[model samples]
Target: MADRWYPMGVPSFSRLAHEVPEPGMLVAHDRALYRVIVVHEDHPANWAEKDRNRLVQNRRAVEERKRHRARPLPREVFYPSPLDGWDGSEETWPNRPRGVELQPMAGGKRLHAGWPHPGWAYWYPVDEHHPVCASCGEPFPCREVDAAKEAARQMVKVEKLMAVGPSCCWHCGEPITSRQGARTFPGENLLLPGGPSPSFHQRKTGGCLYAAKEYEKKWREANPDLAETADLFGPADA
Candidate 1:
């Protein structure tokens, strides 16, 4: 005989949502962009309870994302990170390990991924009032006129100093002395003779400012057997 027992409580399909993995999807909720790591798919009837319950579900992800401005992605991961072009409002799919790709559904022009925040460890904040835009000569904090100020930064010879600051090195947290002006000439090359390549943010900024070449020459004089690692980004354990 076939069973005839009816389920007492009906299930609601609308309540179900995709279950994402670690370092979950970056998305906007409550009119703010954030990384959402979990979802509580209880019945629509139970939304009032679940809405609050979701706070517990997403507490860690919210905390991790709030650490945003303070914790910048390193140059290594930054280079190939699919998150490179990611703006916060759209979805950033976490397909790659420790990284994300901008969601295709959000088909508008992207904003600069919030420049990595310089936490206490690496960068000291730079401040300039009425700083001229390196590109258009407009005043900076120029969100309305031209966004993605990458060009402006480069025009100012921010070169690597653009990584995280007013005018300083990200590696050592020191200011870039002898800037000579508010901006350096475009195409200027400020690099130490024998340090990490300009491909490295440290090499371009502190490598030149800190007299690393002199120190390197002396260090090489002292010891000459340590081989430079091919991958400055670090070893690939996986």
Candidate 2:
């Protein structure tokens, strides 16, 4: 009874009112509400044919749907792994070994399974949506991800990770560890003279070493009173 449904197809108000004679079955016709109504007779200006032919079949479908158990759907994981590229596929992970079959996600890009991705992984209808970067947490066409990629490339160029160790400057012969070490001298000279450099100092007293050494050299030449044996790293009074 409660689960029962009315007829399908177009509703004939006249036929229904005549057969059932329900109290609230009255329908408006020509500005006057009547128990029975006619179809296509008034030529109502607002009502469309599709809407006018109203039908509600199998109200049981709603009740059945409420009681019906749903089929188990596959689990969806968002945000593909950042290390998928670096770590090889041989290593088993959650939902890995047997990778969850992806059906062309929201954007063209799906979850990053691993290196050597199949054609199907990238298969998706063309759309305006762009893929999101896992590391930066920004969508594609993101300037931050672009900058990060560039920084990685620069790091490779500066460090030469595959090489033995930190590279020494070809001209200066000094160990170049960081990117800043590659800078040239004040004179724009790539190489410093093998003899002496200003940055290095010889003295250990109150005055700066380079300055003290320069002063000592100048004082020795000018005063000529102090012996050349005054010493470089000894007490200032000496």
Candidate 3:
């Protein structure tokens, strides 16, 4: 597929191969002989398990013989969101009404609710100045004042969501939205454990947002009572 080519000066390669620069054409490489352009594979040498095993086996010999080293995986590779803590058994979110249930956004889509760093909305400070419409209290179709108030309310919800003690990205204030969006820890920070280590006890890296979901998956996989939970929480409206 990549073998096709277009000339630099002329639009077509076939015509440019022989055309000379008079008013338009320019003579380039000779067209009499065929030249082969080799394309090598760009996959990393240690991409596969077998390649990794071979590399490990040859490590001592390679080091002793001073052979070139294979490139290592980038230290800054993205990590998935860490799992949520408490299994939905405890109340951690603050300034929330009782029995308020906020479902995680769809497509593993992380909402911009602020993580460790304060966001533009934070400086604005949502309050009564931006009150919900007296006519309608629901989220949308409100004035700028109401929108800012809603953003504040949502930010509160987000804080409550994370107060359960989930590990969050430093840049974004919300839960690590996408594992692919996560960056490497820049330095020692509050989110890490004992310095550079991840907080695994409270959260599982790359796991679901709610611990209840994980529990349900495991329970259903092991037991035959998956159908019985229909009356418990019912289907997610998400």
Candidate 4:
């Protein structure tokens, strides 16, 4: 019923002629459920334009078929007939179309159906009971799953950093040893606020230096007065 309001599920298609349902309402057509996205009155000009395009497309398709029919079949098919050993029994010589082939079996050869028709042969509608998010239109529990994954990753990272010990570089999470140049920042660490200040290895590409600068920038923004007097960027440790 178009006049009747459907809270959920597919509405009757018979009443669609009386009144078109508003956008977002689900309707059943040819046993498949579809969500009506838009409703508008058909224009005569639009129909005429469509008819002209259809005629052009039909003519082009006909011409393509004629051209295909004119072309000769593959040379291999003519040189040796694919049906050379057919015994005239339906079981032995099942209809082997142009592309079908025969493969060796335990006793003899058996017909293989070959590849299926190109593209999707059939499409099944989404189950009505299938859960989906109203906001994102993604499968149900989308954001919650993503949030959980992120939390798990963060927990793993924290455990790894703990295993590396406090003397490790905050940026790369590796212990600062005598092998590489290391520098320490003297401000409140942005990653571990109120905790001990973190040090970073002076990588050749200055990646650690950039991370330190970013940390200092955030610290300066938080404590402007202290940042103005503090020398956060000190010389690298020998």
Candidate 5:
């Protein structure tokens, strides 16, 4: 059976950039100037739940843009404390691994792949011993088991931190400090250096929200052509 289409689902950005537009296709309502990357007729979601997630993410992006515009820029005097150790530089902080590149198999099927979550170890019982490698699926001796487990733990931690996305100071593009493998910044409600983190809602607003708003204004001014369409208008219905 073929997949069904819906309006407002997240369109693939990469595809949109490369492909030429076809006739009879409608430009995305969220931002009319930008054409839809993947037509709903072609890249439909597998289920309503997937559709809902895309809708929510797109909505959040709009809200964030609004908040970004309304908020003020970071003040020149505002240097995140040295004690906090987040210098706010992008050169120092790198984007996380792209994870597994997923594509549909058929009928809008999702492929199960991507970087594993960082908190995998916290879920495993350290006291109990398993001989088989959970990640690589290789057999190791009891002595090697701990080593493999530690390696697994390390990969998760590293990927998680990298997952936080670019490490530049959200304000000045200064390199940020990732102390003890923890990606720390000096602001609140801060759009994470990456997408939402596992501990997202739990994070205190720490003034990052204000910093983001300021940063948005600076960026928009720098790039006058980048339309603030979605920022001004909420995501639209089909």
Candidate 6:
């Protein structure tokens, strides 16, 4: 005789009549594979009980999901501090600004508490009237400091440009004459000595073009700082 199959009772298929097979019969239903220990009458009461248990399981699953779902933290909570492991003592944080205190937070985490905010280690106001920069925690309108920083950056760039040797063909290492056809690198005005572009190949001969290209590739690999600046300026014209 051919093997027969029967589905177990579930809430969706409860209305369908299910026939109970003999004991030790193999049953596969709802992803569950089991052998029947004993045969029982297929009754509506048994299906109703199973349905009640399934409903309870579904309610429990929903509640579990809700419990684990992330919710917005309060403004006071801010975010995890870099000093999360620091002990709640001023001596530990010697650099901790005046009026800031080490405050104990939830989950045994400690944070640097400043006026009007918590959990931010660097944020503090100069006074009640002046707002602070979110990053540096300095007073607003820090133009002087910003200008000084920019000047310093420019000075570094100038120094790097000055470090590059005089205008010459990268391939030949020969000094580029004024009469030669030249290709200008990015920031050539600052980079080349006396403000002249490097001569790669003479337009008449074009002999050094391929070698210049290969040499430039290696040069760019060696000088990453100038390579980034070169990318910003894009390909130079002949």
RMSD of each: 22.1, 32.0, 30.2, 20.3, 25.9, 29.6
- TM-scores, in order shown? 0.17, 0.16, 0.15, 0.39, 0.17, 0.22
Question: Residue 173 lDDT in model 2?
Answer: 32
Candidate 3 ranges beyond 4 A from true positions: 1-140, 166-238
> In model 6, where is the ten-residue run with the lowest total lDDT?
1-10
Maximum-lDDT candidate: 4
lDDT of 2 by residue, 93-180 (tens): 1112122222232234323222122322222222233344466533342445445656887676545322322344333333545433
lDDT of 1 by residue, 1-238 (tens): 1111111111222100221222344443111233433332333344354344543444545456556755545763544433334343212422211212232223443322211111111111122232444765433333333334445645554544445444544345355566321112112133333323222122444454344434334444444443243342243221
Best by TM-score: 4
lDDT of each: 0.33, 0.31, 0.31, 0.49, 0.33, 0.41
Question: What is candidate 4's local distance difference test score?
Answer: 0.49
Better of 2 and 4 by lDDT: 4
Candidate 4 Cα outliers beyond 4 Å, as residue runs: 1-36, 39-138, 177-180, 234-238
Residue 8 in model 5: lDDT? 24
Clashes of each: 0, 0, 9, 0, 19, 0
At residue 74, give the lDDT of candidate 1: 79
Candidate 5 local lDDT, 1-238, one digit each (tens): 1121112222223222222233233232111112122322212223345444644554555456456665434751363211122232322211111122223212254333222223211111111132434554432222244556568877875565454535544333344454411222222322333343212111124544355445455545654565344543122210
- Name the lDDT value of residue 32 in candidate 5: 17
In model 2, the Cα lDDT at residue 156 comes to: 66
Q: Which stretches of candidate 6 lie over 4 Å from their true place?
A: 1-141, 166-194, 198-238
- What's model 1's overall lDDT? 0.33
User: 17 in model 5: Cα distance from truth in Å?
Assistant: 22
lDDT of candidate 6 at residue 104, scale 0 to 100: 22
Measured on C-alpha atoms, candidate 3 has an lDDT of: 0.31
